[model samples]
Target: MGFLLNNRVGHLLIAIMLFVAVVAVLLLIAKVADGLRGKARMPAVIAVFAGPALLMLAVGLIYPFIRTVWMSFMDARSQNFIGFDNYVTALTADASVIAFRNTFLWVILTPLLSTTIGLVYAVLIDQSRLEKAAKALLFLPMAISFVGAGIIWRFVYDYKGAGQDQIGVINALLNSVGLAPVRFLQDAPGNTIFLILVLVWIEAGFAMVILSAAIKAVPVDIIEAARLDGANSWELFRNITVPSIRPSLVVVLTTISIATLKIFDITRTMTGAQFDTQVLANQMYDQSFVFGNNGLGSAMAVFIFLLVVPLVVFNVRQMAKNREVRG
Candidate 1:
């Protein structure tokens, strides 16, 4: 018998393996289900609870993290060890430096804008007659993928030369008002900020949903008590509402911060990190895949990972503390 071991056949073999594994899991689940009503079922329950998740975590997260760390120390071929040379280069190189600055800008701007806008919108819409509808409308953008939103906003910011009719909404408006068309994507700092606006637009809806829920969860009695004590609207919002939702606010802020750290889609789709808009994640992609500098890309990836870790850890601790307080 002849055997096929080519690419297509290899993929078929992998698919077959997956199908078998899934079938085995189904059989095991069936067996577990049959034993569910047993008196002493702790072991079966334990397996049901932890088995697949542990296996997936080991295969997916832990393995990839170990692989990435190993890659960081390896050359482009991923064979030769390069010690700290890549790290040092990333820290000092001009492109990497720009990427670092842009990443900091993204980290600062996107979260602040998204969270603040969301909180404000939530506050404004809360208790209003059309609150749900207003919230749904505002939060609709969050349903769009980052790339989709980027493409949408790309058209909005599109511009044409002086005699050509402007196709971009912003430029069209400017032209209607007898103003010059601005190159939204070519401008340095402004372009970066414009890209950030897309992230903010996408994330604001998420922030709004979370913050609105937090607002609703605030005790009515506390607000009534504050109102009776002559707490003005601003005072009630500041002293009562905000304080009550402090934990949620922190969660929103830090969650968005982490998302901002890994921002790549908007940059990649909008400008491809051109004109000084390159953030760390996009820079990593460019370094590795575009420039064929795997070492530099890996180092950038490591840096992004390092930058995100503290934020994630802090967010987790805050969440834990919040849970403790609630408990």
Candidate 2:
């Protein structure tokens, strides 16, 4: 088995297997398409089938993830042999430490702010006449990609010197209010907050949609009973609404947390990891491609994988628990 998996013959055999798999899928799809043309509405049913899509997923996503993990343990050029020295350097190195700190701060802030704002919006918008419109407006930001959002916000944070025409929204407003035009993305703490606001703006909508659905899924009978028992709005929400949607809350938290851990685009686009706004993912890109320090980059990648895996597992377990509860 080892010989089969390790040699040139093994590579050739794997390629052959993959080729056969693709041909078989294409043949099956062609047959399905032909059969569907003879029967109206059956095509829709066939479209929903995910077997072929899963094969693509296995090759595209799962394979690459496994390959990255393997490479993390290997040497810089992905040849030669090295042990845990990369991991050790990642933990203790100056650049890595800075990246780790920034990522930790993002992890702490992003999920909390996004989830809190989303939950509040969800609660307020539930069953309201303006629910659809409010959700549409809030969720509009989610439609924008990270790069687009960063570009938009770049103007928002644009700094101008004394008495010059302030092009940035923030500086314009500050000047109008008789306040100094603050450098929003120049300072350390300020730049971090500015970047965080972009993420919160994008992710809050996701949180709101998921949480709103969860809120609606709360049993009406339970809410009515609580109200009838003289429970106030807060009490009813706490006792009846929140507990019912606790699982969705957990899911949203973990999802946002995972997203936060992999936050690269905003930092990369807005700050270029400058002004001490660097996070783990951006640092990994910089170390690997920009700086050509593959060892450090792989270490950062491994660290991100480690951080995300536990949260993902926890989310899965929470989902299973929810399923069991429902059952």
- Tell me, by TM-score, which candidate is best: 1
lDDT of each: 0.89, 0.87
User: Mind giving the per-residue lDDT tens digits that candidate 2 earns over 179-216?
Assistant: 88988888987799889989999999999999999898
Count residue pairs with overlapping backbones in model 1.
0
| TM, every model | 0.89, 0.82
How close to the true structure is residue 87 of candidate 1, measured as C-alpha lDDT? 89
Query: In model 1, how large is the Cα lDDT of residue 322?
Result: 87
Each prediction's Cα RMSD? Answer: 3.4, 8.4
What residue pairs clash in candidate 1, if any at all?
none
Q: Which run of 10 residues does model 1 get worst, by summed lDDT?
A: 1-10
Candidate 1 TM-score, true structure as reference: 0.89
Candidate 1 deviant stretches above 4 angstroms: 1-6, 18-49
